[model samples]
Target: MKQFLIFVKKECLHIWRDRRTLVILIGMPIVQIILYGFALTNEVKNSRIAVFDQSKDDATRLITDRIAASRYFNLEKNLNSYKQIGESFREGIVRMVVVFPINFQDDLLHTNHAQIQLIADASDPNTANTLANYASAIVNDYQNALNNDQKLPYNIDVQLRMLYNPELKGAYNFVPGVMALVLMLICAMMTSISIVKEKEMGTMEVILVSPLKPFRIVLAKTVPYLLVSLLNIISILLLSVYALDVPIKGSIFLLMAESTLFTITSLSLGILISNFSRTQQSAMFTSMMSLFLPTLLFSGFLFPIENMPKALQIISNIVPAKWYYIIVKAVMIKGLGITAIWKETLILMGMTLLLLGISIRNFKIRLA
Candidate 1:
């Protein structure tokens, strides 16, 4: 036990002595969390919209005023001709164009209905959809106010209540994603590189010749990173909760447990990578190619996995980040307990065991 403690202390000193590793371990997560929380977002705000009001009447003016009053849009320009609408979009001055026909007010007053055309730049589908929805909602609110206390022939109203995120804050979507990505990168990349660095420096042979067994040496090396990974988890949780106002709707203990499991899974994969790599450069390249891109692409971090092709979805199932992401979203967003995410939890556990087994086998073979 004393020897193991000495090994752990030595490994921790080695890690802390390296300024670059310390910065990447601590500083990187902080910067990434802040960047993702504030800058990268899906929610639409202050989108510039152009209006081509051919009606030029009180009703058209009133509707346009309502749109401008809404927080989602800014009335950047009023178009004189329909031709200017295309030019506005072409010049990237506006994302949406609202056109009220010549008889908009008259048709609504006499004919009980009117037509308002909404044209949006579909180049960015999500933004365009949001913009269109905002414009349509404003128009519908105006129309409802106009028809107040009057019964329509068939009124089938649908009330939409956003379940998890009522305010539709984009940070809520990305905080967990950033957590998964940061933890995975740190645990996998750092561990793999650290082990490979020892091998490259020929210190691995010295460590092997010592009384310490290979398993003990690997454990000593991993213990420091495991502690660092836990600290990273705490840092991210604090930032997400206080700095970003993202709520931990479920058990914090459950979240931490799941995070620890994922960290172990990543570390095991890293150890496996280190076994295959002969140098730090190769380990780094392998970690980036294997862990980073897969986490970013297949884990539903930046894109929806359900939207992916069938084969890609199948491939995503093998990604540890994918399961961890599901577990996080279930706990943090939906406030679901272990019962809700047990399948994903089990999957991550299975992956960890598999990776650990393979890494141990490879490590023993190398020693032999």
Candidate 2:
């Protein structure tokens, strides 16, 4: 126990002295949350919209007024012809071009319908769709205003339930991903490289030759990383809950326990990588390209799994971060119980076991 304490103290001292680790561990999350939370928002607001009102009627004017009044769109330029639309888009002047056909008011009065051309830039498909929806909603509201007294056939209304994220807050999604990524980087990557560095620097060899057992050495190395990762978890949680106003409807105790479990899994993964790579650089690179990249890309962070190609969806299944993301989202956002996330919990545990097993086997073989 005393020896373990001494080893842990040494690890802490090393981490404290390393400015690079401190910057990455502490600095990365701050930058990610502030920049990403504000920048990559799902809320569609102040999008540029170009109006080409050919009808020039009161109804067209009213519709334009409605769009301009809504905070979702900013009224930009009044385009004269379709030819200018391409140029406007090239200049990044507008996200959408709304063109009212020549007889928009007449068509609506007689046929109870009118054609309004909407040309949207699909570069950012989600934003483009949101802009189109804003226009459609404005038109629908205008139609309702014109025919408020008229009785409709069948009333079809859409009841939207954003299962995990009801409010569709971008932070809800980004927070967990950031947590996972930060832990993986700070926990797995740092520990793996640090262990490999010890090996290369002859410290690990000296330790192995000493009375301390290999398992004890491994435990000492991993325990510090586990603590560091948990600290990061706390930082992320506090930022998400108090700073960002994201909720933690589930038990804080449960969230911490699962996070510790996840950290253990990541620590084991770091140990496994350290065993494989002969150098710290290789371990760091492997952890990033092989671990972090997949976690960020395939863990439903940037894109939804449902929308991904079938082959990619199958690939995503193997990613431990995806399973952990589901678990964290369930526990934190959805406020689900243990039963709800037990499968995910079991999968993460199983992955930890598998990685540790492979690492131990490889480590023993190397010794032999």
Leading candidate by lDDT:
1
Query: Candidate 1's residue-wise lDDT over 1-368, tens digit each?
Result: 78888989999999889988899899999999999998888879989998999989999999999999888989998999978988998999999999999988999999988999999999999889888888888888887888784657797788899989999998888988998899888998999998888887877877888787777888888999999999999999999999999999999999999999999999999899999898788999999999999999999989999999999999999999989999998999899999999999999999999999888878943433
lDDT of each: 0.90, 0.84
At residue 121, what lDDT does model 2 achieve?
Answer: 96
Clash counts for the predictions, in order? 0, 0
Provide C-alpha RMSD values for all models, in order: 1.8, 2.5
Weakest 10 consecutive residues, lDDT, candidate 2?
359-368
Candidate 2 lDDT over 1-368, as tens digits, reads: 88877888888889889978777877787788766676877788999989998999999999999999998999998999888999999999999999999988899888877898889999999889999998999988888788884657897766567776676678888888887777777778888898888878877766777666677777788887787777778778888888777899887888888888778878888888888888888998999988899998888877789998899999998888888888788889989889999988898899888887776666632332
Which model scores highest in TM-score? 1
> How far off is residue 291 in model 2, in Å?
0.3
Question: After superposition, which runs of candidate 1 have C-alpha atoms over 4 Å from their true positions?
Answer: 364-368
